[model samples]
Target: MTRGDDYVLGRGLADSVRLDAQHLLWKMHKGYELHPLIPRTDNMKIAEIGTGTGIWLFDIARQLPSSVQLHGFDISDNQYPSKELWPKNVSLGLLNSLIDPPAHLVGQYDVVHLRMWVPNIRGNDTSALIQHVKSLLKPGGYIQWEDADLVHQYVKGPKAQEFERRINKIFDKAGLDFRWVSDIPDRLTEKGFLVLESESGRFELDSIQECTKTYLLVLREYINGFKKLPDLDIQQMAKEEEIALDQLYLQYSHGIVYNWSPVSLLGRRDD
Candidate 1:
């Protein structure tokens, strides 16, 4: 599909965007110690949900033994050139988790993985999503879910905490749930899967000014939706709040400060 202007994938960007995404992915992998998910055997099947930019799946296909099969699923159809460079074991497909599973994918994966789906999950009934994921897994297969809490619950600095609170309130006003991390484990357990492991960790960036910039740019499109709230002067306040957020980034650009505290929940389907 054509990369339209409104497309949200981190595509058609300056090099810094790519660098930041890679750095974040590397940090995520390190935080999770991801290697154990792959068994010693050469042949394996893995599925990655919300695989934006397709870089992480490509990296896995490159590093794993050639016999492994890596499939990337995203709502967008912007094919990656990196997939052409990989061995034939890699494939990309469209899998919108909010919709019913495609007929062919039902009960056909060894591992199902997802990352950075916080905003999207907020609009979803996660219990339903978990049940859908459970159906896709082969008996005894695993799932690795990683997402930022982004709710300021574990953030340290005062400025960063305030920024997170504003962002959280904005999302809340927009009717998005910012509490997915606190709720996902319970949803998984209720879906009849065995929670193999669940843990959370925090990372503070030298500056998340760039990250905030991207957020404000996107938030501009939705702020109008909040205009009708009686107590909230969203129309008058949005621009001022956005400007203040931008200024905060400017102050921290030599280092914009931000924190990412994500919860990693791993589960296995009953055999």
Candidate 2:
């Protein structure tokens, strides 16, 4: 992964766009209908794994009482918010969830959250991830996760279809089933979690006004991912990707591109 890829569509712009779109999706979700994604707490321990950009955790911290200790951990500091800029209630850490976490963090959180870690989660790691998450929660604590199955999402313009083929090929090779992660309840149950509740919801997007140029940013991500493959040579396609991305934005602006729903799941640690 070159430094250039993470900076695609400009440094932090892609991640920022993704964060904005996710906020709108969560607001529209049914579970969030009764309560906020992160319910109000007086003084509970909260953690978000693979918390990209830290925007969701930041917003949750901002709205919660300062007594609620909030923390976010990710593999890299590349997109993490500056410590000086993060809310006082929020603590940031560098740790890859794919690896064993430090012992001190075990069973320390009352509620743990994960979202959109698909890009990093491989097929075989699915079970191990559930066990690690279960290990992080206090007894009766909650574990919540949200993921989008892009395979079910959108396919509008030719460039969009092109992006789909390439991206889907990569995801397939990685053995990651991204679109149907709402089916995680079974996996959670297998890992000894009490399936408390789960909800699948779609984000309604009529135009680029709602999608916020997210598809382009995601396309750039996959293109960059493809470029990193040692056996693949996509230099020509990589250059064309920039041009195609502009076309995708035009399609989105004109309402030629539409959206599909993302699924969210919630579980409780029982053992």
How would you encode candidate 1's per-residue C-alpha lDDT over 163-200 as one tens digit per residue?
66776666666566666666778888777778877877
Per-model TM-score on C-alpha atoms:
0.77, 0.82
Model 2: C-alpha RMSD to truth? 4.0
User: For candidate 2, lDDT tens digit of each residue in 111-222?
Assistant: 9888765555544347667777877888888887777656566556666677667655555654546643656788888888887677655455433346436656666666
Q: How many clashes show up per model?
A: 4, 1
List the RMSD of every prediction in angstroms: 4.9, 4.0
lDDT agreement with native, every candidate = 0.62, 0.66
TM-score, prediction 2: 0.82
Model 1: ten consecutive residues of lowest lDDT:
1-10
* Candidate 1: C-alpha lDDT: 0.62
What candidate 2 gets wrong by more than 4 Å, as runs, is 1-13, 30-41, 157-163, 173-182, 205-209, 233-243, 258-260
